[model samples]
Target: MANSTTLSTGKTFAWGGGKSPFSVSYGKLMMWIFLLSDAFTFSSLLIAYGFIRYSYQAPIANTIIKPLQHVGENFVEEMKKAGLFVQDHWPAPELVFNHFPFIHGMHLPLFFVSLMTFILIFSSVTMVLAVEAGHRMKKDEVANYMLLTIIGGAAFLGCQAWEWATFIHEGARLDYNPFGPRSFAALFFIVTGFHGFHVFSGVVLNVIIYLNVLAGTYEDRGHYEMVEKVGLYWHFVDLVWVFVFTFFYLI
Candidate 1:
C-alpha cells in the first residue's frame, strides 16, 4: 500500500514507489548525473589551469601587431623578442592563437576560435530544434535538424584539428611549449582534447540517432525519447565548450 496525504485544498497526494519526484525519466535522470560528474571534471581542470596561469606573471601587452597586420615567418621569435612569450609570463591567448586558415602571416586574434565557438553554439540550436520536432512527431523535421547538427559538429571538429595542427607546427607539444610555459601547451591539449573527444562522441551519438530517425525507429517506438536523450548529451557537450573557451581563450 502506498502512503497518501491530504493537502490544504483537500486533494489527496499519493506517494508511489517508482515515481520520480523531479518529473524526469530514469534515463534523463541518469544523463543528468553523468553530466554533473563530467562538469566537475572540467571544472577541476579549469581551476587548476587558472591557478597555474595566475601564478606566473601577467601576459605582456602587444602593441606592435594590429588585427590583419602582416607578420613574417619569424612571428614566434618576434614575440619572444618583444617579451610577450617568456617562461615566467603567461602567453597572451591572442598572440598564441592568431593564425587563421588561408589567411596566414596576418594577426587576427581569437578569430578562428570565435568562429569555432559559433559553430558549436549553432549546432546546439539545431539540436534543440530537432528535439522540438521530435515532440511534435515530425520525423522529417527532426531528421533535417539532426543532419544540420551533425554537420555543425563536424565543422567545429575540423576547425579544432586545424588549430591543433597549427599549434604543433609552431612548436607546441605536450612536453615543449614555445608559447610561455610547458604546462600551457599540456593543459591546452588535455582540456581541449578532452572536450573535443566529448564533442566527437556527441557527434557519433547524433549520427546514430539520426540514422534511427531515418529508419523510423522512433516512430515505431511510439515516442522520440531517444532523440531527447541524445539531445541532452549534445547540449551538455556544447555547454562544456563554452566553459573551455572562456577558461583557455578568454581568461
Candidate 2:
C-alpha cells in the first residue's frame, strides 16, 4: 500500500516539524480557512433567524417542513396544532411537505428535502471511502467511490433546484406570502437556499477532484491527502444540513 503521506522535499524535510509544516498543504489550509468563513456566514443567518422569530411571535415548530411520517401515537395531533394543516387535527408536516401541490389530498412531509439530505450524507460516506481506498493505493476503487460521490453531489443539486422551484412558487413574498405564512417562509428560503448554494459549489469542487483522480494527476504527484481535505469540506456541508433540518423543519 502507498504511504498515507507525501513528504516534503529538500530543506523543509530536514526542518522536521511534527506535522511537516501543514502536512495537508497550502491549498488545503486555505480551504479550511475559507470553510471557517463560510461557517460564520451560516452563523449570521441562523442568528438572524432567531431574531426574526422573536419578532414574528411565530408558532416555532408548529409549521414548516413537517415530518415525512408519524412517529409516536400523538405525533399527528401535535403536528396538526402547528397551523400548516386543517382537518381531524392529524398533523401538518406530512400534508404540507408530502402533499406539495396536492393540498386537496393527503401525502407526506418534506419529502424532497429529506431526499436531498440523504443524497448529501450518502456522498459524504462515499467520499470517506474514496480517501480510504487512496490510502491503500487502490486507484480504481478510489476512482469509483469518488465518482459515486460526485454523482451524489449532482443528485443533491438536482433536488435543491427542485426545492427552490417549489419554494418560489409557494406564493410567499418578502412582504408576505403563503408559506412565509409568517416570517418563516422568507427565512427558511434564505437559510436553506444559502446552504444549497454552498452544496452546489461543493459539487463543483468535487467534480474538479474527480477529474484530477481520473487524469492520474494526483497519483503521479504521489499523494492524495487533498481527497481527505475535500472530504472534510463535503462532510461540513452535510453537518450544517443537520442543524438546518432540526431547526427549520423538525424543531
Candidate 3:
C-alpha cells in the first residue's frame, strides 16, 4: 500500500512516486545535469587561469600613451622597451587588445573587446525573447528572434577570428608570445577558443530549432520546451563569457 497524507481541507494525496517530485520533465532535468557538469569544467579552467596569472608579477603600468594616440608600427618593441611586455610580468590587457577594424596605429584600449561583449550580451537578450515567444506558441516571433540571435552569434565569431588574426600577426603563438609570458598567449587561445567553439555549437543548434519552427514541428507537439532547453544552453554560454571577459580582459 502507498503512503498517503491528508491536507488541511481533508483532501488525501498518495505518495506513489512514479512522477518527478520537482515536476520537471526528464529531458529538462538531464539538460540541467549536463549544464552542471559543463559549469564545473569552465570553473576549473578559469580557476587554473587565475592561479597561473597570480603567480606572475603584476602588470606594469602604461604612463606613456593615452587612448586614440597615434602609435608607430614598432608598438610592441616600444612596450618592451618600457618594460610593459616582459616575461616576468603579466601584460596589461588594454595594451594587448586595442586594435579595431579599419582603425590603425591608435591606442584604443579595450574598445574592440567591449564591442564583442556587447554583441554577445545582446544575443542573449534575443534568445530570451525567443524563448518567451515560444512560451506563447508564436512561431513567427520565435523564428525571427532566433534568426537575430544567430546573426549576433555569427558576428561575435567573426570578431573573435579577426582578433585572433591580429594577435597572430603581431606574433602571438602557443610556444612564443611577444606580449608577456608564453603562458599568457597559450591560455588566452585555449580559453577563448573553447568558448568560441561553444558559441558556434549554440548557433548551429539555434539554426536547427529555427528550421523546425518554420516546419511547425513544435506546433504539432503542442509545446516549445525544445526552445526553452536550447535557451538554457545559450544563456549558459553567455554567462560563461562574462566570467571569461572579466578574467581575461578586465582583471
Candidate 4:
C-alpha cells in the first residue's frame, strides 16, 4: 500500500494537486466530501428529533389520546368539531397532510405529497437519462432530459411551497404549534424546511447546467461532466426526501 503522502499526491503530475485517490475528478470528490459531511448533519438532526420526540412522548404515555375519527363530506370541519387538530394527541401524518389543491373540504390524505414524491423520483430518473445522454454525446437528448428534470424539480418545489402554506395556515411555527408538542412543528420546519432549501438550490443548479448544455459548453470541452456533477446533487436531494417522507410522514 502507498503511504499517505504518496496517495495524497498521486503517482504522476497529471494526477497530483488535489486529485482523488479513488480516480474521481477533484470537483466530484469535493462533492462527495461535502455530501458526507452533510449526511452527518442530517443524521444528527434526525437523531435529535427522535430523542426529543421520545422524551416528549414519555410523560403522556398513559394519557395518549386516540386520533379523532372522521368521515363524510366535511372531514376537516369534522376534525375541527372534535377538537382533533394537532393537539393533545400525536398528530397522524395522514390526518395532517389530508389536503388537496383548490378543492376545499376534501380528505385527500397523502395524495399530494405522494404525487410530489413521485415527481421527485421521476426527476432522478431523468437525471440519470441526462447523464447517459452526456456519455453518448447526444447533446439534444441531454438537453431534453435535463429540461424535464428541471421541470420536475420546479414542480416539486412549488408543491413544497403549497405544503408549507397549508402547514402554516393550519397552525405551525417555530415556537407555536397545534401539534401535541412544540418540537413537532419546530423540527418539521427546521428539518423539512432546510431540505426544501436544498431542493430550491438544486433547481438553480440544474437551470445553470441546462443553459450550459444549450450553449454547447460541454461540446467544446468534449465532456458533460458538469451535468453528471449536478446530477449527483439532484439525486442527493431526491434521496433525502425519501428519508424525510419516512421520518416526517410515514414513521
Candidate 5:
C-alpha cells in the first residue's frame, strides 16, 4: 500500500520505485505474446471455416437447419428402443427450419447467436470501462465494472448453453444434419460451441483476477496494470466473437 502511493507520485521515483525485468515484467510481456498467438489461432479457424463453406457450397444443393422428418407422436419411444430417432421420412431443408412467426418460411436460430453477440459486446464495453477506471486508480470503480463484466460473461455462457441444448436435443434434429457438408448444422454447432469454451475460460480467469484485485494484491504490489493486461484478453475474446458472428451467423 505504501509502495503504491510512492509509485503513483508523478511516475518519477527516488527510493520507493518499482523495478522489474525488461523495464516492466516478463510475465506481462509473455501474456501479451500469448494473446497475440491466440489471435492468430482464432483467425485461422474462422478463415478455414469460410473457405470450407464456400468451396463446398457449390456441390451442396441445400444447406439449412431443417426439422426432423418421419413419425409424429411416440416417435422417440419407438426410435430409442431401436437406438435411433425415427428417420423414415425426412422433410426437405426448406420445410424444416423455414417456420417463422406468422411468416411461412425457413429461418435459422441465428437470432440467438446475434443476441449472444450483443451480450459479449456489452461485456467488452464494460471491460474497457473497467480498464479506464484502473488507469485512474479508482479501485472501487474498476471493481464494479469488472463485476459487471463477469456477470455479463456468465449470462453469455448461460445463453450459449441454452442454444447448444436447442441444437443437440433430439427433438430439434434435422434428418440431413447428422451427415457431412450437406449439414451446416454440425459446423455451426462445433464452431460456436468452441467459442463458448473460450468465453467460459475467460470468465474464470477474470474472476480470479477480481478476487486478487479485491485482496489488495494489486495495490500492495504497487500497480493495477495487471487489470489492464487482463482487460486486453477480455477485449480479445469479444473481438474473436465478431468474426464468429459474421462467419457462423451472418454468412
Candidate 6:
C-alpha cells in the first residue's frame, strides 16, 4: 500500500516507496534532463542551418576557380583530364571532405570522417558493454571497456582538430570561404566545434571514472552506479554526433 499522510487542510498525499520518486536515482534523472535540454539546443542549430541554406539559394555571380588544394590533387587532375575546371559553386559536402590526413592530395571522399564516425559508434558499443559488466559486477571487464571508450572519444577529438586545421588551411573562415556562402563557413565551425568540445569533456570524465573503478571505489560502495551515470553521458555524446554527421555531411 502507498504511504499516505493527512495534512491540516484535510488533504491526503500518498508517497511512493523508494529513494527516488520514480525508481531512478537522482544522478540518472538529472542526466536525462540535461540530455533533453542539449537536444533542443542542437535542434535549433540544425533548424537554422536548414532555413539559411534554403533561403540563400540564389547563385552569386562572383565565381572564382576553386583552389587547387581545396579539392585535392586527384580531384583537380580528374577534372583536367576530362578537359574541365573546378568552378566555384555551392560547396558539395562530398568534395569538401574529400581529403584524408597524411594522405593529402588524394581524392577519398568522406573516408576519414567515416572512420571517425565508426570510432564514436564503436565507443558507444563499448560503453554499453561497460554498463553491462558493471551490472554483472565484473570489474575487469568494466575497466577494459571503459578504457576503450576513453580511447575512442580521445581519437575522435584528435580527428576533429586535424579536420578543423585542414578546413582553415583551405581558406574557410567565419566571414570568408572559398565555398559559395559565408554563412556556411560560420555554421560549420560553430556547430562542429561545439560538438567537438563536448566529446573532449566526455573523454576527461571517462578517464576520471575509469581511475576510480580501478581503485575499487565502487566495489567498496557496493554498486557501480558511477559507471552507469558516465555511460549515459557517453551515449548522449555519441547520439549527438549521429545527428551532426547526418545534417552536416550526408545532407
Please, what is the TM-score per model?
Answer: 0.94, 0.73, 0.94, 0.83, 0.67, 0.83
Clashes in model 1: which pairs? none
lDDT of 3 by residue, 1-251 (tens): 13345558866544435556556888899999999999999999899899999999989988998999998898999999988899999999999998999999999999999999999999999999999999899999999999999999999999999999999999999889999888999999999999999999999999999999999999999999999999999999999999999999988
Off-target runs (Cα >4 Å) in candidate 2 are 1-24, 58-96, 100-104, 180-182
Ranking by lDDT: 3, 1, 4, 6, 2, 5
> Candidate 6 residues 146-191, lDDT tens each?
9999999998998999999988887789987665667878999999
- Give per-residue lDDT, candidate 5, residue 128: 90
Pairs that collide, model 3: none
Question: What's the true lDDT of residue 160 in model 6?
Answer: 92
- Model 4, runs deviating above 4 Å: 1-20, 58-88
Report per-prediction Cα RMSD to one decimal: 2.4, 7.5, 2.8, 5.1, 9.1, 5.3
Task: Report the Cα lDDT for candidate 6.
Answer: 0.80
**Native-referenced Cα lDDT, model 4:** 0.80
- How many residue-pair clashes does candidate 4 contain? 1
lDDT of 2 at 173: 53
Best by TM-score: 1
Each model's C-alpha lDDT? 0.92, 0.69, 0.92, 0.80, 0.66, 0.80
- State candidate 1's TM-score: 0.94
Please provide, for model 4 over 4-78, each residue's C-alpha lDDT reduced to its tens digit, 9 standing for 90 to 100: 335454545434444456778888888888888888887887888777766643322322223232335544455
lDDT of 2 at 130: 95
CA lDDT, candidate 3, residue 212: 95
